[model samples]
Target: MFLVESKGGAIACMLFSLLFLGTWPAVLAFLERRGRLPQHTYLDYSITNLLAAVIIALTLGQMGDDKPGMPNFITQLYQDNWPSVLFAMVGGVVLSIGNLSTQYAWALVGLSVVEVVSASITVVIGTTLNYFLDDKINKAYILFPGVACFLIAVILGSLVHSSNASDNKKKLSHLSSGYEDKVVYISLLFLSWNKGASKDPENGKEVKVPAQFGTAEYLIELEDKRSIKVFDRSIWLGLAITFFSGICFSLFSPAFNLATNDQFHLLKKGVPHLVVYTAFFYFSVCCFVVAIVLNITFLYHPILNLPKSSIKAYIADSKGRGWALLAGLLCGFGNGLQFMGGQAAGYAAADAVQALPLVSTFWAVLLFGEYRKSSRRTYILLVSMLLMFVVAVAFLERRGRLPQHTYLDYSITNLLAAVIIALTLGQMGDAKPGMPNFLTQLHQDNWPCVLFAMVGGVVLSIGNLSTQYAWALVGLSVVEVVGSSITVVIGTTLNYFLDDKINKADNLFPGVACFLIAVILGSLVHSSNASDNKKKLSYLSSGFEDKAGKIAFDSNKGASVDPEKGRQTKEVAQFGTAEYLIELENKRSIKVLDKGIWLGLTITFFSGICFSMFSPAFNLATNDQFHLLQKGIPHLMVYTAFFYFSACCFVVAIVLNIIFLYYPILNLPKSSFKAYLADSEGRGWALLAGFLCGFGNGLQFMGGQAAGYAAADAVQALPLVSTFWAILLFGEYRKSSRRTYVLLVSMLLMFIVAVGILMASSGHRK
Candidate 1:
C-alpha cells in the first residue's frame, strides 16, 4: 500500500488535515444557525463521510505494489485483522458521539467557546494517551508543554463564555417595555446602552432599548427558527455536554493508534499490524454506522425538546443538504490525512491539530458574528486563548521534526511556502535557472526597461495613496467597485493590444462591458446610500437640537439632574443610529467636505488610471513590445522587473508618507516623523499587510509573464473581496433601503461574471 514514510510528507498531511478539520465544524454550525434540523444534516453528512473513506481506500490504498506483510486495502479486508478492526470501530463510534454532542453545545456555549473546550480536552487527554501508545516516538518535553497550552485555553474559553453570557443577560433585563410594539423604531438605534437607560424627554424618566443581537428580540427569533431551542436552557447542560464530548474526542485518537500499531499486542505474532488506510476504513465505517443509527433514531424521538422528525421529513428536507454533504467530505478527508500523518510521525504529534479552535474562532467571528461589540474582558480572554493555541501548535509541529537549518534555510521558508502552494494548484512546474540569465542581461544593457519598471512602481504608489482618501469620501463598496471596474476596462484592453492580441478579444471585451455596467450600477448604489445617510444625519441633528433646548428650558425652570446620570446619557447617545456615522467621521484622518463626492470621484478616477497604467508599463518592461531597448540587450525578466518595481514603490511611499506626516492635507492633523515612529498601535499589522501585498503583486507578475498580462488583469475584481469585508467588518449597507441592496448585489454579480469571462479569455503566450 502507498505510505507516507518521509517526515516532510507527513507534516504536509497534518497541515492540510488541520485546515480541513477546522473548517467542517464551521460549515455544520452555519447550517444549524440557518435553522436546518441537526438530524437531517447529520444523516446527510454520514453518507459523504463514509464515501470519502471508501474513495481514499480505493485510490491511495491500492496505488502501490502490495507486499506480503503490508497488504493492500482489499487484501486486508479478507485477512485476520479483526482485532485491529474492532479497535478502529470503537474509535469511530466515540468520534461520532463526540461530534453529535458538540452540535447541540454550539447553540448553547457559542461556536468559538465550544470548539476551544472540546479541542483542548482532546489534546490534553488524547495526546497523553497516544504518547505512551506510540512508544514515545514524539518528544515528551515539547509535546507536554503544548498540552499545557491547551489546558490554559480551556480556562480562558470558559471565562469568555461566562462573561459574554452575563453581558447578554444584563442587556435582556434592561430591554424597554413595549419594545415589541416599537420594533421598527428600536431597530434604528445604533450603539445603544447595553447595561442602562437614557432619559425620555417627554416623560422625564429613564427608558431602555436593545442595541445589538443578544436581546430579547434576537433570542425569540432564534427560538422560533432554530431546531435546537435554546430558550430557558441552562448553560450548565451545554458545558456538561462539552466536557463529555471532549472526553470522547480524547479516546478516539489513541484507539486508532492501537488499531494501527497493535501497541498492546492484541493480534497474533505473525499477523501484520493494520496499515493507516485499512485502519481508517474500518474506523470510518463504524463512524458512519453509528451516525446513521443515532441520527435516524433522533428523527423519530428527538432530544433537547427539538421538533419531531421522521425519515420522510429528512428525505424531504433538501434546503442545506449540499452544505452538510460538503462538511462530511471535509471531515472524512481531514481524518484520513491525520491518520496518515500519525502513522509516520506518531499519533501524539498528530494530536496537535486539536488546536483547531484557532481556525474555528476565525470562522466564528467572520461568518457567525460571534463577538461583535463584545465586552473588553471577553475580547481579551478570547485573544489570549487564540495565542495559546498558536504557541501550542508551534511546539507540537516542532516536535515532529529534527532541528537543523542554516540562515538560507530560514530565509527561503516563505518563498518555499508560496512555491508549494502554486505547485499544489498546478499553477507552477519545475524551476528554471532564469536568475543567472537575468543577471547577465542586466550587465549587458536594460536601462530603458528599468525605467519602465520604475515608472510602474511610481504610479502604483500614487494609486495606493489616493485610495485612503477615496474610501473616506465615496465609501469602501463604491470606491472598490468603481476603481476595479475602471482597471479591468482600461488595463485589460491595454494589455490585450500590448501582448499582440494573445488574449481572445471577443471574450475579453464582453468582460470589459460587464465591468462597465457594474460601474454604472455601483454609482447608483452609492448615490442611494448617500441619500439614506443624509436623511439619518438630518433627523439625528434635529433631535439633538430639540433635546438640548428642552434641557435648557428645564434648567431655567430650576429643574436639576444627577451629574452621573447626565454623563451616562451622553455616553449612550454617542452610539447607534446617525451617531455611528458621526463617530466614524470623527475617527477618520481625512475629513469629508460638502462637495467631497465630486473630489472623491476625481481622485478615484485618477487612482484607477494610475492602477491601469502600472500593469501595461510592467508588460513593456518584461516583453519590450515597444522595442525600448538597445540592440543585443534582452528584455527584463519577471523577477527582475518586479524587484525594480517594488523598490521604487517602497521609496516613493516612504518619501510621500513622511511628507504627509509633517504637512498633512484634507483637514488631517499634522504630525512629525518622531511622532510616527513613536506610535506603536497596529504597527505589526501594518507591516504584515505590506508583506502580503508585495507577495501578491510578485505572484501576479510571475503568473502574468507565464500566461498573458491581459488575462492576469482578472485580479482587478478586487471589489468582490472588498465588498464581502465591507459588509461583515464595517457593517456597510446594513438596514439600507431595498433598492440600495438590489443595486449592491447586482453590481457584485456583474463583477463575478466579468472575472470569469476575463479568466476564460486567457491564451498561451507562445
Candidate 2:
C-alpha cells in the first residue's frame, strides 16, 4: 500500500520544482537579465529554505509511521538503463533553451490600434490549429472567436505611432517608456502565448513563491515617487493574472493524467468500476474548470475598431512590413513550445508534481533554441511536425489493437500542432532584440558578438552533425545533449565576450587565424563528415549481412544502380564494412538535422540583402512622405505616409519569398563571365523571382509616374495583386489541409473587405 501510494508522487514533485525554480530565473532576469543568480546570500538562502519545505512535506507523506519507507521509487543508481538516462538528460537540455519576453511585447502591440490588431493574429493561428486538433471543440471557435483573434493580432502588428500635425512621426519607442496604453497591450499580448508557468505546486508538492509579487508595480511607484517606470498597476495586474492562471492550470494536470488513463484503458467489470467513479466525477469538473478559464482568459476578447482611412493608409504604406512579419513568426516558434507546452503540461498533470515543469521556461525554450526560433517558419513547422509524429509513434506503444483511423488522426494532429507551434515559436523570435544586423555584416561594431555567434553557430553545426551520427548509432539524447552544450557555450560566450570594443583588427586575427587553422578545424569538420560517410557505408554492409540471402546491396561503389525487387532502397548501405557502420538508422534526428547550419547561413546572407534593399526604400519613403511640406504636391506627405505603411507588409512578404527561393548558398548568382551562366540552374529561377519583383516595381514606378501622387495607388495595386496571384500559382506553400486552406481563404476575404474600405476611403484624400 505504501509503495503503491508513492508511485507517481515523486515525478509530480520534480515537475513542480521546475516551475518554482523557473520563476526565480525569470524574475531574476526580469530584474537584471545580464547578471547571474546571487550566491551564498539571502536570495540563495530563501531558495534553499523553499526547497527544504517542499522536500519535507513530500518526505512526510512518503514516510511510514514516523519513518520514511525508502520513498516508494527505487532511485536506481543508473543501474541497467544508461541509454535511457542519457536521453532523459538530453531531453531536459533541449527543453531549457527558451528565454525571450521583452521584445515580443512590441511585436504584439504597437502604439496604435492597428498594431494591436496585428498582435491578435497569433491567437487566430493558435485557435485555428487548436480547433482542428482538439478532441472537444466547438463551431464558435472558427467563425466567432477565431476571426477575432486574428484581427486583433493584425491590428496590433500594424498599429504604429503617427506624427502629430506640428511634428514628424517619431519612431515608436521599441522599449517601454512613458507608454501606458501600449504597454497594457504589450503585457496582455505577451500573455497570449507566454502566460509564464505555474506559480504554485501540486497536491503532493510545496511551492516557494517569491513574496507573492502581487501589485508590486504599484508598490514600487508608491515607494519611489520620483521614478517614472514601465512597471505599474496595470502591468502588475497583468503579471498577477498570468502567474495566477498558471496556478489554476497546474491544478488541471493530474486530472488530465487520470483522464488520459481512463480514455485509453478499459476497466474491469466489477460492482464499483474503478474508472467509472474516478473519471466520471473528476473529469466533468475538470472540463468545466478548463472551459471557464479558456473562455475568460483566452476566448473572451476586446472588440476591434480600426478607422476606415487608417486601414487604407496601412495598405498604402506596406513597405517595412516584411521584417515585422518574419520577426513575428520567429518569435512565435520560440514561444509556442515553451508557452503552449508549459500550459498544456500544467493542465495535463492533474494537480500532481508533473505540474512543476511550467515554472522554468528555459527547459521548454532550449528545445526550440534561439536560432531555431529565428529560422523560416516552414522549417520550424517541419521540426514541430516531426516531434508530433514522434509522439504519435509513442501513442502506438499502447497495449491494445490500434484504431482504424489511427494514421489519419495522428497526421492531422501532427500537422495542426506543428502549425500552432511554428506560429508560437516565430512570435518569440520576433519579440527579442535579435542578433544585431551589424554582427552578420561582418562589421566592426558588432563583430565581437557576431564572431562569437558565428563560432557558436559552427559549434552548433558540428554538434548537430555529431548528433545525427550519434543518433544513428545511439538514440535522440546524443543530439539533444551535444546540441544543448553548444548553445549554452555560445550563448555564454556571447554574453561575456561581446562588447563595444571589437573592431576590424580584432576580427582580422580570426579571419587570418581561420585560414592558418583551416587544416585543424577543417580536419575536425571534414573528418567528421568523412567519418559519417564511412559509417553510412558500414551500416549498409551490416544490413547486407543480416539479409544476405534476402537482399543485395552491390552498388558498384557510390554508383547509383537499382537492383531488382529492392527499387525503393536508395537509402540502402553499399556492399562494404564502412557502409554498414554509418547507414542512416535514426532517420528522425538526421532528417532536418542540418537545418540549424543551413538556416544560420541563410539568415546571415539573406538578411543582409533584404535589409540593404528595404532600408533604402524605407528611408526614401519616410523622407518623401514626411518632408513633403515643401517638396512634392501639397498633400504628398499624407499620401506617401500611407503608401509606405502598406509597403511594410508587402515588402516583407516579397523578401521572404525571395529568400525561400534562394536559400541554398549555391543558389546565388555568379558574377563573372564563366561563372555567370555556370549557375544557370539556380540563376534562371532567381531571374524569374527577380522579374516578378521587377514587374511589380515597374508598375508601381509607372503608376507614380503617370498618376498624380494621390492616385498612384491604382498602379501600386498591380504589384500586390500580382504577387498574391504568384504565391497562389507557385507551389511554394505546403499543400495545406482543406480546412486550413478554407480558413486562409476566409482571411483573404476579410483582408479584401478591409482593403476595399481602405481604397474607398483613399478617394476621400484625408
Candidate 3:
C-alpha cells in the first residue's frame, strides 16, 4: 500500500502542494498581463514559460535527494530509462499545448469564466487520473471523499468569482455614467447609433439616421433610445477552448506519474534517479523545443489580439521583461514543488493541491476587489466553498498520530510575530532622548487645540483626496501651480476678513501675488526641465531594447502607439523608429489628460480652497471665538490642538479606507486585515513620520497663537526648505543642465521673496 512514509513527509508534501497551487495563479496572471499590454504578444508567454521550465530543471538537477547516498540529479537522469524520459517529454508537450489554449481562451472569454472552467475541470480530471494511475493507498475512502469535496469547493469558488466580476463591471459602468452629463450622454448615444444603421425602437424597423439633424429629430432619437447589449462570438469560442484545455492539463500529471512511478514499474526497472528532478529535466527540454517551434509558426499567422511588431516591441520593454522574468521564476518554483509533493505522496496529495482555488478566491475578494458589491448569496456560496476545501484538505491529509494544524494557527503566529516586532521597535525608538513619545503626548490633557486640530485634519484629508483625483484627470504641473496659488490667496483672504485686523492690499494682495508668481515660475521650471529631459532622451536613444527589454525611451510619455490600432503604420516605422516611438507615447499621454481636463481642474480649485481654510479653522478655535477652553496653560492649547488633529486624521483615514473597500467611489485600494498586519512590519518608520508631523503641527499652531494666522501661514511659503533639502541631502538636481539650475534657483529666490512679503504683511492682533 502507498503511504505518507512519515508525518514530516506528509507535512512537507502539503506545504509544497499549497505553494505550487498558490503560485500558478500569480505567474499566469503576470504572463497574461504582459501579453495583453500594448507591445506584448502570446510569444512572450511562450518564451517565459519555456525559460521557467528550463530554470526549474537546472535548479532541481543540482540538488541531491533526501537519501544521503543517492546520486546527484545529473547522474540520475543520465542513468534513467529512456521510456521514462519519453513519458516526461510527452507530459511537457501536453502541458505546453494546454497552457497556450488556456491563454487563448482567457483572451476570448473574460477572466472570470476562463478561471472557473479550467480550475474546476483540472481539479476533477487531474485527481481522477492520478488516483487511477497508482493503485497504492493507505486510506482510499478518505482520499476519494476528499477529492469529491475539493471538486465541490472548486465549483463554489467559481460562482464567487463570477459574482465578483459582475459586480466590478457594474461599478465601472456606474463610474462611466457618473463621468457623463445628461447632455453628453444623450449626444454620445445619438452619435453612436448614427455611426451605423440601427433598428428603430418604436417600430423595431431598420433605420439610417444622419449624424447632425434638427431638434425634432433629436427629440425622436431620445424617445427611441433603448439599451442594447451586443454579445461577441469570441466569448463562446473561448469558453469551449478553456473547457478542453482543462482536460489537456489533466493528462500532464498522469504522464509525469507514468514516467516517475517506481511502485507501478511503469518505466524500465533499475533506474536510480530522483523521479521529480529527472522528470522535470526531460519535461523542460520538450517544453523549450515545442515553444520555439510554435512561436515561429505564430510569426507567420499572428494571434488575433497581438500586433505584427509585438514580438520586437515586447522584447524592447524593460519593465515587462522584469515581470516576465519574475513570473517565470515563481512558476518554476511552484511547478517543482508540485512535482516533489506528487512524487513523495501520491496523486491524491497532488490533487488535494487543487484546493488552491480557496487561496485564489480569497485574494480575488480581498485584494483584487472581487465581490465588493456582491449579493449575500455570493458570500454564502463563497463561505460554503471555503468550508468544503477545509474539510477536504483536513480529511485528505489526516493521520491519527499527527497533530492537526490549521491556517488560523499560522495566521495567529504571523500576527503575534508582527505585533511583538512592532512593540520592540517602538520601545527601542522611545529610548532616544529627544522628544516626548507619541503615547505620552496623546495622554496629556491638551483638549481644546486637540479638538480644533482634529476638525481641521478631516477637512485637510478630504482636500487631499480631491487633489489626488484632480491629479489623475488633470496634468500634474497645472494642478500643482494652480492649487498652490489658490491655497495662498484664499487662506490670506479668509484670515484678513475674519480677523478684521489686517489691511487688504498690504497684508494679503501683494503677498498673494508674489506667492502666486513664485509658484507659477517654479512649476514652469520643473515642467520645462522634464520636457527637456524627454527631448534629450528622444534625440540620443536609437530605439534599441534595453537589458530589461524595455525600449530606451519612455513610451508612455512620448511616441508609442497601441500596437493593435497602429499595426499597419509602415509610414511611422519608416520614419526614424525613435521619432515614431516618441510620438506614439506623446499621443497616449495627451489623450488621457485631455479627456477629463475640465472636471479635474474644477475639483482641484475646490480642493485648494478647502486646504486654505485648515489653518484658519484651528486659529479660530484656539485663539479667537472658541478660546473659552484655552484659559489654562497656553502650551496646553497647542498640544491639545495637535492631539485632536492627529486623532482626526487617523479616524478620517480609517473611515474613508473602510468605505472605499465596499463602494470604492474613488476606486482607491481597499484596506484589509492582511494589509494592516503587513503594515505593522514598517510601524516603526510610520510612527516616526507621524511623530514628526504632529510635532510640526503643534509648533505651527503655537506660532499661529502668538503671531496670528496670516503670518504663521506666510512663513510656510518657504518651499526653499524642501528644495534645499532635496538638493543638498538627496542630490536631486545633479543631472540638470545649467538652464534648469538657473530656473530652480530663480524659483527658490521667488519663494524667498514671497515669504518675506507675506511675513511683512502680517495683520495686527485684535
**Candidate number of the best lDDT:** 1
Candidate 1: 10-residue stretch with minimal lDDT: 399-408
lDDT of 1 by residue, 145-221 (tens): 88888889888878878887766555555554332333432443332433446888999887765334545455444
Model 3 per-residue lDDT tens digits across residues 393-477: 5555331110001211222222332233224322345423323444554454556546666677787656655655564444344
Query: lDDT for each of the candidates?
Result: 0.76, 0.27, 0.54
Q: Provide TM-scores for the models.
A: 0.53, 0.23, 0.44
lDDT of 2 by residue, 480-515 (tens): 222222222222123112211122223222322222
Better of 1 and 2 by TM-score: 1
Alpha-carbon runs more than 4 Å astray in model 2: 1-251, 259-528, 535-766
**Which prediction has more favorable TM-score, 2 or 3?**
3
What is the Cα-based TM-score of model 3?
A: 0.44
- Model 1: pairs clashing at backbone N, Cα or C within 3 Å: 190-576, 190-577, 191-576
Q: What is the lDDT of residue 440 in candidate 2?
A: 23
Query: What lDDT does candidate 3 reach at residue 470?
Result: 60
